[model samples]
Target: MGERAQQIPFYCDGSYLCEPCAELCRTKVQRQKPVKTKAYKFNYQCQCKFMRGGCKLRYQGEEGVVLSEEERSKQKEDYKKYLNEKLLMMAAREVPLNRLNQQQFEFSLESNLENAMLYDDEITRAVALSCIPPEIVDLASNPVQQLKELVNWFKFEFFSWCDKPPCPSCKSDQAVERVGSDTPNAEDREYHASQVEKYLCKNCKTTVRFPRYNHPMKLFETRTGRCGEWANAFTCLCIALGHDARKVLDWTDHVWTEVYLAQWERWVHIDACEPLFDKPLTYEKGWGKELTYCIAFSSKEMVDVSKRYVVDPVLNRMRRDRVNEKWLADTLQQRREALWSMQGDSQAQFLRKRYQIEQGHLDAGSAHKFPSEPFQPRQSGAQ
Candidate 1:
């Protein structure tokens, strides 16, 4: 069984398992040398048939080859060696990945927004028509108007939000069930997918592939995914349309975009899924969602912009245990140096100063609490 499968304590299908039946399901596999793959599902009927739905807990089979003791030891040794090498590389600052929290920064930092510009004209026309009258047709002159139009088009007409994908074979949304997840294969990686969700169709027993494509241009073809896809593609489009944009990643398992409006000289929050614009506090005050780290990634720089979104710094700090704050700060500074090294002195200086100002705000925000008067629910479905 995979690491994640073994850790699950219960499954929710409105089914109950008696104590004895649950104990049997838990220990049966460990006590015997199993012939089947170690994966378990909570949907099976117990042999006892003691309960109404017969206990939705059963082992798939006892039918697979087992690993020997020697092989297990070899695997453990190899993993330890790999970890040692990874630690050395991280210590050298060769990679910006957080040691304790790998998800603190994106592994693939190269911008794919340039690919999105390939269809700039098509997107421009769509955005122009999306705006309200007196309709702003020439987006080149008015960047802010252009951004608003683009957001409108992308959110309402361009992409879709998928909760559970419809089963292709049975053509039923409810027929498909999530079995497990797997690493993206070579073909799926072409779309820049980090993971692929596996679903089983009850009617035809067909395994469906739901690759969460991260490359925005590739997403133009799929047009359907969760918040990750929506934010990715939208951020790409924002850059493609000549707006200075960044992909804002929330460690709390959400993402959105931040576009730098030169007119305002600051970044503005935008959520393509909710179709919301410039509402940084919406996640905290409106949805009552507690936030931790909110990092913004652009082609030039990676920034820590958590202060702008967090409701109460002291309270939210409790959830910010992924990495020591000082270590994270130092790592970010090192990464900024590396990323900005290629630019001219003037440009590099400008970015460095801007980053300093942003960090100052983060430092100041740490000392206070925010008002809770504007409490509201999430605009869309659950993130």
Candidate 2:
């Protein structure tokens, strides 16, 4: 009414004004721009903020029932039992094969010694003198260094990843009738259990036998295999070269090799498939695997080597605990001992040493207390 053109509705915040003044105030409010001040530095001044605003230091989730010390002890024991059993089973399958291969390995070495550069001192020395660069040879001052060199050379030599060796007769790239003989032949006599894939050459009326030999010697001659054969054969070569190595198996369905580095006092992972040496994170970090168990089996012993791959043990071990810990442990222990004895070729001295070392490994729970450098997985499409 007084000095106003129109009547304004009553405001929420009771400031009395006419329609024009109210409209003007609304326009001014609407036109006002937001203050372009720096973002507020929040220290989570509220409990709700702390709980819901994603504070790193805050408990990640609702706290579960606190485990008793006794319960925790029991769990650890059970976990040990379960995990060891799996380890032993892996050992059972691999150790026998290793033994069978080992039995024939020495024979193979002897036959090839004259031609094998490393085994034959004459040829080896000659190569060292004339072939290998002096600088490179000089770098191999230790066994590990020599191993790296051998591994690099091996990568070049056995680069072929042939599943079925091409028919030698007609050089045909075709599959023939794969025949499995119940018994062994003259050439396949030693590798009796080895599945002989008899391919009928489409080109020629010839039967080509690809004896999928588990023997490293056979692998050496053929120079190609799947992950298992590669790991198995490579480990044997590491052994032959006198570098203590093991066949590393993953419960997540993978296989690789690990050579015991005496100088570092640790087992270094080496995958001939990825051709990655000392890249333990190649699986978890690179492959993005949610792995539970990674067991290492040599002729002498087995160890739960999960720490080599997984950074967060607490997360992974939760899954491992899903199985019955007690029964698993007992059965695993029983089987391991039985299988260790079953090998029949393990040296008494080595067995004794291995036993002592394995006991030490068991006692020292949670391997990688110090842990290795934070593993950054290589960014690649290939896992």
Q: In lDDT terms, which candidate is top?
A: 1
lDDT of 1 by residue, 99-121 (tens): 64644333432333332233244
Model 2, 3-64: lDDT tens digits are 22112233323233322223222222222322222332222122222122222222122235
Give candidate 2's whole-model lDDT.
Answer: 0.51
Query: In model 2, how large is the Cα lDDT of residue 223?
Result: 62
Candidate 1 overall Cα lDDT vs. reference?
Answer: 0.62
Error of 1 at 60 (Å): 62
Position 365, candidate 1: lDDT: 63
Off by over 4 Å in 2: 1-141, 167-189, 192-210, 318-323, 335-383
Best by TM-score: 1
